[model samples]
Target: MKKKQQEMQQQQELQQQQQQQELQQQQQELRQRDLQQQEKQQRLFFSSSYFISFAAAVRWLPPLAFGEGKNLTAAAAAAAAAAAAAAVAAAAAAAAAAAAGVAACFFLRKEGEG
Candidate 1:
């Protein structure tokens, strides 16, 4: 009877250890997921800020080019065209930057995994 009790106690302890390990593994996975989400958000924020600054520059510079005596209609049209071009360029650049960032992250993750 004593031997049977000892065996049962050992089995219970092993089960408890296994449960603890599983819980730890789950927690680690959750932390890793959170880290990945944070990194993604950071990349998005960086790209968006870059685009916003570039757009602001595009919007602000056309007036300077027109100077103090330029025709209002011509200036407005020029500004519109400049804004359109800048928007396209900024979008492409932002996309490229974001892609590069994500790729770099993937490579770093691979390295860490290995």
Candidate 2:
């Protein structure tokens, strides 16, 4: 009877150990998933921030340049005109860049889903 009891106790202990191991594995997997989610979020935030900064620079730089040129002599008129033209070009480029960034994000998302 004592031997039987010892054997049963050992079996119970083994089962408990296996359950603990399974729980640990599950916790590890959950942690890894969380980390991956955080990394993805960080990437998205940085990309958006970069896009915002680029857009703002494109929008404001031309006017700032033109304003500074006004402080100069008669050449300031020509410089201001050139700055305005450059601003238009910059706006077009910013639009193109935004489009490309959006396309890239979509492509990456598709790849991740696959």
Candidate 3:
């Protein structure tokens, strides 16, 4: 019984060490990929016309949408924002109604407010 227990403990420790090594390897790989991506982005940002084009596009996008077609994506975003705001209002109204009901049952019932 003592030998069997010792063997089992050794196997568990071995498995744990293997797992730790695998985890360390995975972390190292992720750090390397991230570093490579950062270097690529830095190189592109310094060398490409994309940076200037992006800046000019951003400067013009708002005015273009306001001036023409009512710009599809901006309209969609505005609609989504309005819908979210409405949902918030509806939730607030429901909460107020629930609170009123609870108050009417407890405090308001004692008076004439119920």
Best by lDDT: 1
Ranking by TM-score: 1, 2, 3
**Tens-place lDDT digits, model 1, residues 1-114:** 999999999999999999989987886787688668866965777677557656655665656676745555655665676567656766766686688679767866875686
**Prediction 2 global C-alpha lDDT:** 0.65
In angstroms, the error of model 3 at 17 is 0.2
Candidate 3 residue pairs in backbone clash? none
lDDT of each: 0.71, 0.65, 0.62
lDDT of 2 by residue, 1-114 (tens): 999999999999999999989986886687577557655765665566556545544554665667765534544454555556556656665675677568657855775586
Quote each prediction's TM-score: 0.55, 0.52, 0.43
On lDDT, who's better, 2 or 3? 2
Candidates by lDDT, descending order: 1, 2, 3
Off by over 4 Å in 1: 61-114
- Alpha-carbon runs more than 4 Å astray in model 2: 60-114
Model 2, position 65: C-alpha lDDT score: 69
Clashes (N, CA, C under 3 Å) per candidate? 0, 0, 0
lDDT (Cα, tens digit) per residue for candidate 3, span 70-112: 5756655555655565556556555755765575457435633
Better of 2 and 3 by TM-score: 2
